[model samples]
Target: MTELIAATGSPSWDMSRTREMVRARWGDKALEALRPVLRAVTTRLIHARIHFQDYQRLVSEHLRQPLEAGTPWWELMWVDEEKGIGASNYFFIAAEGYVYAGVQAQHAIADNLAHVLYYSLGWNVDQRIPLGKVSLGTVCAQLARETTNSPELAPIQQALDALSTAPAYQALADVTNHIKHHGGLPVRVGWGTSEQTPFEVLLSAFSRKQQTQPPREIAAFLEETYDAMSRAVVTTGLALNEWLESSVAPAPPDNSLHQDSTPGGQELHPTDQPARV
Candidate 1:
């Protein structure tokens, strides 16, 4: 059941057994402090999964709803019978929206993992830890520090390492960063024909430095990103579950909790106070 749950792209840390173990060792306060952060992580996973599935559905539907026989594929239009409006490339446009949404959520999950790992280490509040600005690389770097002394944390470090180092991970990050900081990448959505049959294709140049790079299939690119992100989430969750189960008896020290304070003289805890994202 644990394997199946993780395989389905749900966080492994949410398992009942893991929660029970955490509660037994860390006390109810730990669970209480972590509930919201875990929920936020799961929420982003839900968004990413929904967008991925929706984009796939749209791709399949677009293939089935091809232009009428002999009609030019370039003349892509959607007619609203009630409003008497014909919108151009509406289907692909909607699918593209899902693509962007899924990408955003997937990247956001990487950011959220920093919160998960931090809180899991028993730090309830610390102003030094950047909440929203934390990146996957940052998370991996923290994990490196933790695993140095506690070899038991090696699995967690490995899981995050695989995620941060994956080619698709960097590609997706480049695309998302480009979208956020620079401008949206040029995307081409239309119908194409091959020896087999006519099909819909959504293509984009993912290279941040080269706009003229040959366009790659958006569906395939997103599929790779989704798979990589899902695997990382599941693997991290499993590693965390193991950590929680094994390290439960001696609660880890809250290194950051007592050492830092917010500007208002309050301890920086994400549960008790909102951390700037």
Candidate 2:
């Protein structure tokens, strides 16, 4: 399964397969106990990947406008330039939103999974972890401490460590924080000479910090980030599955903690069979 997922070059999860593994090792109660949070993580994961794909598609399809060598930064235009003033602005603005939302969703996946781990370990509300905030770094730090003493959680810790150290993780966090706390992040689309294509359509962030640096293409960066997130997702899923296989039955879920988090018409329940991306 791991080899197949890697070969596809895209992240995929088998929700029903996970449920069957849980049911066979533990019972139906454990399956139900974990379903809600798993579904929430799934929601964020899918959305993040989908947003990235959409951004790539939109940019690739519309980056056909021709520009000369001396074209001004403000003059190099997106596809909708013929429409009027501010019409082309929508193109870049929408692309910015896609990247922002995609990064934010990737960050949320960690929190949703942290919630899963928090309950799986039977930590009570008296525990001082700030589960409500949007700090992946903070939640992951607490998880590190909790998992350090238990050899059973070693695999989970490895996944967390990989995610925390991933270049994409920190880069996305910086961009997310800059947008949320500092100020606006403007998206710039420009043309440059390239060996592969006549027009190298560059999508990049604009801020005071980046102003001193040369504008570089971000396609590789975004692709790297997405691949890193995919690896984390795959590793985390396998770790959880293995842990469930060796563990005792989990306690029944507190009904109050189970909320309706499923989006895109998907249900929170998982079946005996494996699912596809």
Best candidate, lDDT: 1
Q: What's the distance in Å from true for residue 170, model 1?
A: 1.1
Worst 10 residues of 2 by lDDT: 267-276
Model 2 agreement with the true structure over 35-59: per-residue lDDT tens digits: 7776667666567667877777666
The window of 10 residues in a row where model 1 has the poorest summed lDDT is 267-276
Clashing pairs in 2: none
Candidate 1's residue-wise lDDT over 155-251, tens digit each? 9889889988898888778878877886665556654566354654655655567644456677677767767776676678778878887776655
> What ranges in model 2 sit over 4 Å off?
1-5, 8-14, 17-33, 65-83, 124-135, 201-216, 249-277
lDDT (0 to 1) per candidate = 0.62, 0.58
For model 1, the superposed segments whose C-alpha errors exceed 4 Å read: 1-14, 57-63, 68-70, 77-86, 125-133, 195-197, 206-214, 250-277
